[model samples]
Target chain A: MKSANIQLETLVCPSCTQKIDGALKSLDGIKEDTLKISFATSKVRFDFDEEAVRIEDIEKAINKVGFEVIKSRVK
Target chain B: MQRFIFRNKNKIALINGILIALAFIIRWTAGYMEIFTGLLVAASILGLIPIALQAYQALRVKVVSIDVLVTMAVGGAFAIRNFEESAIVTFLFLFGAYLEQRTLNKTRSAIKALTEMAPETAWKLMDDGEFEEIDIDDVDEGDTLLVKTGAKVPVDGRVLSGEGSINEASITGESIPVAKEAGSGVFAGTLLDNGTLQIVADRVGEDTTFGKIIELVEEAQESKSEAERFIDRFSKYYTPAILLVAILVFLFTRNVELAVTILVLGCPGALVIGVPVSNVAGIGNGASHGVLLKGSEVIRDFSRLDTMIFDKTGTLTQGKPSVAEVQSYGDGIDEARVFLASIERESDHPLALAVLDEIGETDYLEVTDTHVVKGGGITASVGGCRVIVGNQALMTEEGVPLSEQVREDMRRLERSGHSLVLTAVDGELKLLMGIRDPIRPGVADDLESLKKLGVKNLVMLSGDNQGTVDAISSELGLTRAYGHMLPEDKSAYVKDLIGQGEIVAFVGDGVNDSPSLALAHIGIAMGSGTEVAIETSDVVLMNSDFSRLPHALGLVKATSRNMIQNIVIAVGVVLALLASLIFGEWMNMSIGMLVHEGSILVVILNGMRLLRYKLRPSYRLGSRE
Candidate 1:
């Protein structure tokens, strides 16, 4: 089995602008991509295998921790 | 009681009906043609409007509303020689509705307050610069506007160039004026308390912060609390049940006339007006306070929550990192001096800004070859001395070796509940500073009240590392702590707790707390500050204060209790009156009317307990599981 990590370029609450990093990192099979989240502009990428975790699963994982994974169109 | 009766038009309606009924009976007995004619005519004429209005409403609307039932009750009472009773019934019914309207109107002020949120007029550009005179919706983004002292900020934008104290209390609920320099974020609806700012509008209309609040509050589902829903369901059948009982009595007793009396008595007029009147009044009370219970459902759920878990950041702390402590390791340099020099030349992180703000002199340092390395720290040359200011990785990447003590020092700062910044001059570690978000005021006291309310265990969850979460949790005396969490991590933790058989509430600012907030038994959003938080929660605390948690819990408690009292009052008074009418023939029309009127009044006033009720300190946060 192979594993890959992708930085979530903009893992922040679109409303609060707080980083949604550790929250997404806390889920099983998902690992933090060691990237610094830029407030309002940057995303925190995560790396996981497609067979292991889907993007929707990753979103659900992010949601569980009290932070949001906003896809910032502005950025 | 005073607020409820006058605050809502319904109460005023019932009270007016009672007073006029007294006048009608007295004038009828006097029997002077001029006086009786005048009195009867006035009462009948007053009575006709409600009947016509209700009939029109019923024909226009599809449902068999209370208005239709009420209109029929009044007409039937009048047909059977109970003119005063009919007059009072119709008048009270209309009055009760009016009170409900008035109460709702006051509550709608939360939306009206939304209007005051942003400036009504905005600047429009012409061939000659720009002049202020148009609606906010008309003003597009990129329009330049001038905001003066005491003026509400016209739009959400960056300062083209100005400095001032912006009163964000309208949106942020921060009482003190926030000092806004150029580039500091300013929101529309915040008042420019000091200095002038020429801002370019970044967002307008529904996109503006104020517009979003109105949209969110309107979309809030103000469901009836649990206790009220129980009564509401019961009443749906209860009213018809009473009418059937009246019919059965007429069939068995073989007395049509008395059955008519029973029917008139069974109208359940007071019962019908009781609870909603209370609810409308209750909404008044909630608005006067900062808590906005979206619906009766939230109030009901709040009545039952025994355990609550709060997010530590933003909910309990300011969430903005400020420089807390400085430590130095080199000769000829103190902790503050190195921090000042390093941070001055450092990249723009929140920690750097905090340190720079404290030091004040950027002109003192000559920096060359400055660069902010991604995920690493800054590399620069300060005063012919090569300097590297950043986290540990920046130095490690630059081949700067650190002693074991420096690592220990960084660990100590992190354990103390702050992020640590490492600074090295000439490739040797020289400075370390701890940066942290301060605990919000009144947090402990609010938690203490939740304890009194029988909250079993207080849990602190954070995306920050375990060390930071543990330190804050222990400091706050919370029972459990989970750290190094990502957004998805919070929901899983909450689900785990719920799986363990606990009714839990998640209190957060609503931004990062979306999944957990949605999944919890209740989701409480920080008032109006953060958009997503307010948009996606059950309760909106108009003021983002930890102090409000206790008050919100208390309100739900009081409201739930009142709803029960109302249901009992509604059923008890009507059922008792039915028994009295059947068993006690001595009870005449006037006296029967009096008992009915009194019971309705009692139930109504009882419901009003939600209005002026005082909450005494009762429960404390009890630890369990």
Candidate 2:
């Protein structure tokens, strides 16, 4: 399993995190328990199975939800 | 084009606002109803694009956001042909979002400023022995980097050669330049004020101390507190509940305007944003001031601290022992000190180092017939004279007679918490020196400030002997003091205090203090302390400064209070808007959205006040020596 931290542009409202959270949860290979999207820091953290999905796919999912990804790190 | 509209939503908001004003003016002055209606329709459609787009995105994810409520209210008003109401509501929503984004960015500026200060480039030493500039990410551990005057130290490393004074404000929040020479350690992001240095990197990138500080602070600000979790849960059901209420009202009364107004007023914009702004601002302030509050939970616990326990060595007193007093018995005192320095040079005891340090400069002498007395002292012949350096027990063994005056001096030194080191030359008592770890300067004033901040009890626990503990405890005006406590004993005592209904915060440094640091209600570790202590503790005072203690307590108190104030402001504004709508005739969709956005700005400005927080001068610990 690989963990990733994704930074987003500033989130204006707390409810907006729900949109990104729903987007990431719907993707394949992402761990449900490790998905944490913080509206305060405009960052998302989650663990995913590397064999099933790549980080770029996860960023695409977030982008499709109308939020821009500033940067991401996977370890 | 969609992306451009999203990026320039504020510009569109300005155009919509002008259209609304022009329509209002035309309707009142020229009575041109067709042009007024045309302008109103254009303005409403222009403002609705961004909000409806956001609402569509939210709905695609199965989420009910504030944008959804605004979109529904504006669409309902348009369906009912309330052109004035529709135009004003959409304009208010867009303009409100613009103001909110601007002020919310200000609350987050503390972390933004820190990220901007991160060093980006480094001068790397090539294999050819020439220096070349490189990106910071490209530099690796064990690589040698050359740092010039006014350039940031690109990595955490030990100085291999050269010298300079570096400003370490980014790491420790102190702007004063600290001198560095060969073998001195430097951290990333510190600027070399003058001179040059060649350093071999020990830690690079995120492994550097500055990087860890940024990461820790970012995580801290993002972590939720108890109140925040409650608010999050509250809003989860709140928006949907407001929608249900709006639907029921329209079904029961057949009143479209009343239902739309309820939907607009029920947007919990202020309540959703209030607590987080305070949390982020508080943690940011702590990061900038060399104090790390770890998370909102730690801030809550620290502000309620009732008793603070301190380890004697390092936390309260200088850990290094030094000579405190020197008394000589007879003539040839200079010769006696020379013999003392010579004998101490050969011994590895801590007291021996203090003796040699106090003597400063001395001549070396050939020694003969050296004997190490078990737990007594060292006995040797120096420069053809018998020299005995040890405690009084060794004096008794050597039959060195002690006069009544000498005995009185010994008692006085012991009472003052000094360990005695008596030196005798040729069986005559020659010199008596007192050694102890001196209490850190200005600690008394810092303790006073802690008291002023409402810490009910101040206690100290130490492994040192009781006399020294008593002396220090009395001098600093601590309420209680304990001596000869092992690590387990200290943690057990902290447990006992917590069991008895007292909130405890333990301040300590060193490996032995790690257990207590973990067991206390709030563990505050000095930044320069061991890795285990820093990792186990909840709060860290960067630079190991004792003065930041009172400041840390004061800051948390102010932060938690600010959070409550924001919560009240948010909830109160929501209640006022609702009650005014039901009890009075003046409430409408535009007025509701305007007040909702105004309340958010108010809470954000309240949270931002923490960024300028400083311990007042009267409560600040006096200047250090």
**What DockQ does every candidate get?**
0.01, 0.67
lDDT of 1 by residue, B181-267 (tens): 777778888888899887788887668776676544433322344554565466556555655765687679765446545544555
Model 2 is docked with a DockQ of 0.67
TM-score, candidate number 1: 0.68
Model 2 TM-score is: 0.94
* Model 2 stretches with alpha carbons more than 4 Å out: A1-3, A49-57, B123-134, B138-146, B157-169, B172-186, B193-202, B621-625
| lDDT (Cα, tens digit) per residue for candidate 2, span B1-625 | 6567787888999999999999989989999999999999999999999889888888888888888998999999999999899999888888877877888888888888887788999999998999999988789999999999999999999999999999997776567999999999999988899999999999998788878877788888888888888888999999999999999999999999999999999998778788889889988888777788889999999999999999999989988899999999989999998888888998999888888889998787877788999889999999989999999999999999999988999999888889899999999999999999988878899999999999999999999889989988998999999999999999999999999999999999846788899999899987563345457889998878888898899999999999899989998998899899989899988898889888988999999999999988877756752
DockQ of predicted candidate 1: 0.01
How many steric overlaps does candidate 2 have? Answer: 0
lDDT of 2 at B409: 94
Interface RMSD of each: 22.4, 1.3
Worst 10 residues of 2 chain B by lDDT: B526-535
